[model samples]
Target: MASAVKVLLIDDASLIRRLLGRVLNQDPLIEVVGEAENGQEGVELARTLQPQVIILDIEMPVMNGMEALPLLKKAAPKARIIMFSTLTESGARATLDALSAGADDYVTKPSNTGSFAATAGQINKQLAPMIKALAASATTYPSIRPHAEPKAAQQTVPDADHSWLTVTSDGAPEIVVVGVSTGGPQALQTFVPALPADLEVPVLIVQHMPAMFTRLLAERLDAQSAVKVGEATNGQVVKPGEVWFAPGGEHMYVTRQGENIVLTTDTAPPVNECRPAVDPLFESAVENFGSRVLGVMLTGMGNDGLAGSRLIKSVDGYVIVQDQASSVVWGMPGMVAKADLADQILPLNEIAPRVVDLLSTPRNRK
Candidate 1:
């Protein structure tokens, strides 16, 4: 028989522990090997059990997640730790810090739904898939990816011998649209700040995140980047050299009105099960800029950008994707590459510089 995924649960509340156990036990392949009520106990449990996955809550007694994260990492270096955080500004900031400190990902803790049974269902809804995906990834070592994938951990660009659809295509780019999720916070920290301040086009992004977290991410990026970064506001005039992120839980779209392009946000139904989805934004860019748009798909889970990328390709708009080795989850970019929709597949470090070089190429204007 296959070995079950050993899990360690760490949260202050006894109720949460019991509820987590209820759902986790439902999965035949997952076994909750240990439970702890505080960071101090959690660290002890991790050192002893050496679980495959750790579900850690941010706020706790005897030591908070912030204090225990580094220690837990030290105790079990190979474990995939998923932080449980409240959906608030401070929580968002702390969660980002956890990610930087090597936490794999996080879950926004849901509010009480009156009864323990109802809340258990809610928790399972969010936690089940996340834990399963992480476990599967952990079981297969990073180096053991499929033959079609490039070195997933490598940071270098793929060889030039590969057939790429674009070196520099005809018209100068009028806009850049980015779709990223999962490892986006860290990836953006490195990538966005590297772009030139005097870039000739506006850049818009859709990052799958919550409300307070999106704003905090924008603020953090703005502080580090040469180009100003801000969360997209409805009816704002999309200006050159600025970076605008779609506010979480809303759908942001771009449209040309007269001589100026503008952004609009709405509470529309989600695409690919994400509110701030990549498809709507990419489709809008295709409608507005056509061949003058650059679509970038970065590290994320699921095939959120595949349709959008296909639409972009149909319009002669160029696309670039983060290669498998450097991605947190290669789902988005992998789909694009397999579909032959991407013009360039670059590592994280090479993407920004390539953008500048691509735009620098001479264009023939009508």
Candidate 2:
């Protein structure tokens, strides 16, 4: 049998630490190796224990999680770190900051911890799978290569594995729709900035996050990117040279109003357990743009985009995905790849350049 995943918990609250420890230990695949009350202690214990995963709280005295993050990384370079954050505005902002600062992922603390059993159940359900995924990926997965310049400016054909995808788009892409989760913030930080400012097609992204985090992410990415980036709003006109993220807690779609394609949002029931699911956006894109869709699937934890990718391909729309070696969790793109839906499978750094290449290609406009 595989050895249990080793985990270290760091939080200021004694009750939280106790509850987390109890719940995590109950999982047969997990073993709680240590606990710390603050980042300083966490860092020290990280050095000694070298646990596979570290769960660090954002708000703590005597060295907050953010302050100790780099230190913990330095002390235990191989360990994957998951931040524990609140579900408030500050928590959302801090979680985004942590993700950009190299934290693998995060889980929000329960707002009402009034019932020990309920809180513990939430922790177990939310945290254990995350811990296992992160730890397994860290120990068994290859190290992520630093983002670098695209190797070639010219468009490249799909690899032999994708030779079955003989059909190609008949027209230059009119819109780019991206579906990402888990490691999305970090991936988008590498991707969005690389897109040229004069891109002729608007880009729509669905990154699984809460409402505040999605808005904050758009704002943050816009600050760094040459192209305009913001959260998608109802009735906004979709135009070239801008990037829009689906706001958390809502599914964003596109509709044709007269001659203009406009963005739309709805509170429809969650698909695939996600409010801003990729399927709805992809399906809507196909409906609005027909064969002019370009679907890009980045690193994420589940197969949310698989169905959408299928829709894109059925109409000869192009679909590309982040390759396994470059993914934080290969589940999303892996599913599409396995199903032969991707026209191209690329690393995070190359996705932007490839999109630009595909968009620039001279194809018949139908």
lDDT of each: 0.81, 0.85
* Per-residue alpha-carbon lDDT of candidate 2 for residues 223-338, written as tens digits (9 for 90 to 100): 99999999999988978999999999999998778988799998999999788999999988877777788899998887898888887776678788898878888878877877
Candidate 2 clashing pairs, residues 3+ apart or interchain: none
**Against the hidden true structure, what lDDT does model 2 obtain?**
0.85
Stretch of 10 with least lDDT, candidate 1: 148-157
How much is the lDDT of residue 82 in candidate 2? 92
TM-score of each: 0.87, 0.89
Q: Residue 358 error for model 2, in Å?
A: 0.5
lDDT of 1 by residue, 126-177 (tens): 6776676666653332332222221111111233221223322467888899
Which parts of model 2 are misplaced by more than 4 Å?
A: 138-168, 362-366
